[model samples]
Target chain A: MKRFSWDEMMNRYPAFFAIILLVVALTINFILQPNMFARDTLNSNMRVFLPIILLSVGQAIVILGGGIDISVGGIVSIVNTILATQVGLNGSPEKMWTFVFVSIGAGILAGAINGFFIAFLRLQPIITTYATSFLYVGFALFILPNPGGGIPAEIANVYRNTTPLGLPLAFYVIGVVLLVWMYIRSTRYGNYLYAVGGNAEAAYETAVPVTWVLFSTYVASGFMSALAGIAITMLSGSGNAEIGVPMTLTSITAVVIGGTALSGGVGGVAGPVVGAITLGIIQNIISFSRIDTWWETFVKASIIVVALAAPGIINLLRRKKV
Target chain B: MRKFSISPPVAAILLAIVLFLLSGFLPNGYGSDINVAIAQATNIVRLAVFLGVIAAGQTLVIISGFEGIDLSAGSVVTLTAILTYVTVKGEDDKVLLALLISLVVGALIGFVNGLGITFLKISPFVMTLGMSGVVTGLIIIINHGNVSGKVAPIMTRLIARPLSPDIPIPNAIIIWIIFGFLMWLLLERSTFGKHLFAIGVNRVTAKLSGVNVTATNLAVYTLAGALAGFGGFLVVGNTGVVFIALGQPFLFPSIAAVAVGGTLLSGGKGSYWGTMAGAIVLTLITSLLTTMQMPDSVRRMVLGATLLVMISIYGRQRGFRQ
Candidate 1:
């Protein structure tokens, strides 16, 4: 029989820690709300988390490609604004579909802008995205100065109530996302992503399409952010200029918790997806536990800090043992 | 380091002149009257002071290298302002004590961040990002979402008042000059400053060359927090009210100012004067946009596009060299 080692398992699967966290959070949530898995409650919860789950997958891809996209939220805001204003409160389904396509296109355009500056122009990923974020949010604000416009009730209800095979509609979306990610991971471009993120110079020397790979990651992130925006708009059943601001930091936190390294070339979409859900569950636990409203942000942030520091602390301990 | 070429600071000066000339086309142009120019200059200086102070610490951390950035600066500023106002409670006599306490609190937070980065090996980006959340949470907890306090009369006058009838400069401008000089001395004159640049250039080599890398990192982050706290005080003085969102806008502009000032986001290779110039340029750009009666959206788009162009000039050179 082969000997088992915790380190080997962690090395082989970077999501180990995140998986454990998710299990713990989910168990606590289940205990708090026994009916959490019930059809209605599950659908509502899944509906809310779906946006972040999609956002995290995109963020994970960017991080894996050895860059960070701080403008995801801005891109999300743009999409939300597009849908809210174009579809209006009483728009028909045809108009909604048309606007949805337009919103996605807008997201791709925003991502392309970021990618051109960072990948082709060779700007710092963080700074370039930070600058572009303002451009996106500012544009969103221009599109909808106030937070009043929203899609029709029927569209939102479709998002909220849809269930297929007794599972929430989000489950199907998640399934599709994972399937797509898996397929991409098996492709040559996927290998190129990891190689470039690990070391762009090394990858370039080995003849990888370094710049194109870099560009595509941001585009992918943009598309994902657009999806997240649509989900959020549907979930809220309204539009706000500032809706996407808070999501940016949360998405990054989710990426970190998912066991992805900020230095890049490690972790995957699964970890971040789990990380996003874990974050959502943690929020549920907090609310279910009846913590003070004031302490909610503090407690959640402290939890994130702890989560961020855990791997580093564990590595130090391992090194000491060695 | 190389043959003479136009650096960012020089470029900033040139840009300032071009902007000034362009502003001549405005109905109330800079050259229209001497008094108008002074008023405009003072306004720009006043706004730049807040951004410059926050960016000052950022410059130090970024100079110290290792992908150093302090995203929590804006949150710290907000927290410190709230703490200062609440503790002082509009009492002139309590200002000094409140300021001291705020500084200490800021330092403690910074120390936690440093500890996480140094001992736990957390990524600076993630650690600081988490710290921002924690600080914001603390603000909410303390204020319970109902912040109420007035800026101390003396503190308000200290920043807003003119130095004297003979001197047209506001006290804020004088204070900024002192802070700017001090930052310049720290970055260009001090041994710690030298070590920072060296470390930013290459951490292992700096460590091998006898730099106390850990100690330096700790000190820089602590100073950054303290400086951010001080910025909080200045902002409160300027606004005369303590609110959660007061310091929010400073977050990106501070970083942008540092980048616009020509500091390398990858760490090291920049100057404080460049940052000061950058801050002024940004404020000028905003003011000019407002003067032209452009909507907020257009202003933001212009700012974002300009930032992209600026970074492209700097980034292309660096990207190609590597």
Candidate 2:
């Protein structure tokens, strides 16, 4: 039997590091804010974090599949705009639900466009998505040029106040996402995803459906981005074409902090989920610490930089010691 | 023997000309009058200089491979611009000092980025992304999210004004031409350039060939940082005022320009001349769209579609076996 070690565990599960980091961040947040675990506070925090969490999951899947979707944020904007315009503030719940499905379909179609360029035409993922992001965001702007439309207040309240079984609604959504991920992980397509990401040429040589897997990853990313858009829109009860732009980089950061390698085929959804939460907690800690308001951005950024560089620094130290 | 080809730079120039002629047909566009068109073309070229300067750094980093990218370029530009503003204090005599300070700060940021990436083994994308956050935070802390500074008179004269009474060309264009030439030489004629391309093509192979990968990477990143800083300095000169997130808009365009210039985002092959042409082409597209009186949304969609089509036509990657 092989012996377990810290390094071995980390190698086997990259999320281990993220988990430890999350625990530390949570502890600091708790110390700073005693009411952090209170139902209301937890709900608000989760609601705020949910969008990035959702975005990160999709980003993680794409990264794991050896590609990236820079257009996810744009897709989010498109969905938000679609929902805001089609299902106006006075629209009925049935109309809202109808638009929701339409939004998801739009996201999938947008993703398919990215997939076609990247998978079928073999364009670079970064550039392809970067260009398409403009298309999606532009379309959103066309739909809602002034950023004023929104869903009904009642629907917004449902997202804002909902707590099922004394837990935040976000928790349930996360649970479902995890469950679905687990099932996917158990399937052949999941194996193919890893293989393709790890080494596309090798996977192709072994008869893995490389193009399909790559295409699906982008599609999945689009789907999740749409969900994120819906969650954010409901929380804010408004639509803004530019809202999702910043979230793109934030989601990528969360995935990296979650221990996922940008090079692909490493890490999982769980790590990024925790990472997204950790990011929110870190923000909470910064806010509750009573630091000067001007220092807030700097402090948060410094923490992120340290977090990004920490693993590599530790490895360097370890190598030196060895 | 090498096969005859138009090359990316020439192709980009040709495309820019085509776009320019096409825009003439649009109502209120410059192509109706030869003098008006010449003036408009000159204005577009002036606008493109900034992007060209910034994309020069991007070209270098991309050519250095290992997934080399500098997401912090925009932030660095903002940081340096603010720093220059603070240092110059609107004094023409202090411009040189401000320039030095900006370059140093920019190089320092790049050095830190390189340290994290090369020595610490952090991915360039994550390191730069984190650094971007840190830089933004630093900016907020420095100015309390309110930027207030006047550019020196000489800077305005050089960046925004023409060279002389008879000279229709802006001094910035002349400066850009000189800078572009130097960059072209550096990439094509320098030993460092050769090492950069080799590293981008294959790190291990370059290392085995006795290339100092770490040192070279560090230098490239530092240079890139300096260029971004210089760009910031120019931006301040052109705008004559400093503001928060001033460099934000330049980020995507810089990357896009690099890609359109025919540089492979995956690295190993590229040229500054190509990037320059790309900047010109992008500027022409934006100008054309603006002249057509289209809404922002339609403009964005068209831009996105254009980039997608352009990339698909010329930027597709060869298959693995090939």
Candidate 3:
């Protein structure tokens, strides 16, 4: 039998490092707040992290497809604005449901626009999405100019406080997402996605539907972003056009920390899922550590930087030793 | 014979002129008064100069390829501006010292970024994004989230004040012209330019062809950082105030300007002249929108849509098989 090598293991399971990092982060959080595992604490923490987790999963898929969707945040903003405005604070539950579907549809439409440009028109992904992001955010601003509207508290409570079988609502959502991802991963479309991302020309030559794969990734990202928008809206019970803007880079960071290569075709959604949660936990650790409030942003950022740079730095050191 | 075609830079200039002329029809815009028009034009150019200076670095980074981008440019600008303000403390004599400090700090940050990307093999997107976070945290810690300090009088005279009563032009414009010229020479007329293009086109091939890819990349990033630092100094001088997140707004616009200028985001081909024109075009659009008195939401939507349209027209990538 061949000996197991660390490099080979990492290559085979890109999320391996993310899992380790997650455990480390979780332990630190537990130490800082011994009751971290309590149902209430876990629910609150998971509720807050759900949106970014959703966003990161979508971003991972896009990265896997050899593209990126900077406009996802814009999509999130649009959905949030739609929900907050159309649903209103005291709107009927029926009205909220109607708007939820409408929001998702709008996300798909916005994503389709990005897809058309990048996949069909063959525009550069980064720039095309960057430009479209402005449009989406702008539309969001148009929808809710003052950031005052919100979903009914009754509806928001469902997303915030739901606990089934002693677990948070977010746990179910993540489970369903992972299950769906697994199903997708075993399908022909999934194979095609990887093939295209690994090498578009080769995939094209080998008769993979490269254009369709590329297009679908952005659509999926848009869909996930809409979901995230909804989750975040529920958590805040309010809306703001600027809320989603900062989340864009954070989602990207989570995906990278999860070990998904930006060059594409090398990672999966699980890593990003863990990475996003780890990020949230890091924030918790920062707060619980009793560090001065001024040091929070710096320490969080430094930790992320280290996380991003660590894998590469380790490889460099290993090579030098060899 | 080659077909007659206007280059991107020239076309951008023409578009800016047309936009300016169209804006004249709006109420309180440049209507029927040559002096007002000249004044408006000067103001547009002056504002564009700041963006141009920032975009200059963006152009260089984008042209260096391998998904090269400096997401940290904005944070560097913010940090440097604060540092300069604190150093100068409204004294003309300390302005030079402030400049030196800003450059060194910016360069140091970029060096770390380059080290991570070039040596540790971190992705440019992740490395810079994390670095921006780190820089943001640093800023908060340094100032405890409070910003104070005043622009030096001489610095203001150089950046914001008119050159002379008769000339009615800011000294910043003259400085930008000189800076642009030097940048043009660096990108188009120097051996370093050739190496940069080579590395951008194909890193392995460039290495095989005797280009020092690592050194060139490091230099490009360092230069970009230094430029952003200088931009920060100018920004404080122009605004005559210091604040946290001062550089946030410039991040997207800098990249947009580079794209509009016809720099290939995939790297290898670009020019600073085009970026200058792109900055002017962007500034013109903003001025026109403001002149029309469109609400902020509508303005954002229009800007996003316009960017998408413009990029579609000029930035289409080659088909996969091609």
DockQ agreement of candidate 2 with the native complex? 0.84
Q: What tens-digit string does per-residue lDDT give for candidate 2 at B170-206?
A: 9999999999989978988999989999999999999
Candidate 2: deviation at residue A209, Å?
1.2
TM-scores for candidates 1 onward, in order: 0.96, 0.97, 0.98
Error of 3 at B29 (Å): 1.3
Q: What are the per-residue Cα lDDT tens digits for candidate 3 across B1-322?
A: 9977677788888888888888788877778999999999999999999889988888988999999999999999999999998899899999999999989888888888888889989999889888988998998888776666777899989999899989999888899999999998898899999999999899999999999999999998998888888888888889888778689889889999999998999999989998999999998898788878899999998998888888887888888677
Q: What TM-score does chain A of each model score against the native chain A?
A: 0.98, 0.98, 0.98
Clashing pairs in 3: none
Question: Once model 1 is optimally superposed onto the true structure by TM-score, how far is the C-alpha of residue A56 displaced, in angstroms?
Answer: 1.2
In CAPRI terms, where does candidate 3 land? high
Interface RMSD of 1: 1.6
Q: Model 1 off-target regions past 4 Å?
A: B1-4, B28-31, B90-92, B147-150, B320-322
Cα RMSD to the true fold for all candidates: 2.0, 1.7, 1.3
lDDT for residue A139 in candidate 1, whole number 0-100:
97
| Candidate with more favorable, higher lDDT: 1 or 3 | 3
lDDT of 1 by residue, A55-163 (tens): 9999999999999999999998998988899998999999999999999999899999999988888899998998899899999999998888999999999999999
| Chain B TM-score of predicted candidate 2 relative to the true chain B | 0.96
Candidate order by decreasing DockQ: 3, 2, 1
DockQ of each: 0.70, 0.84, 0.86
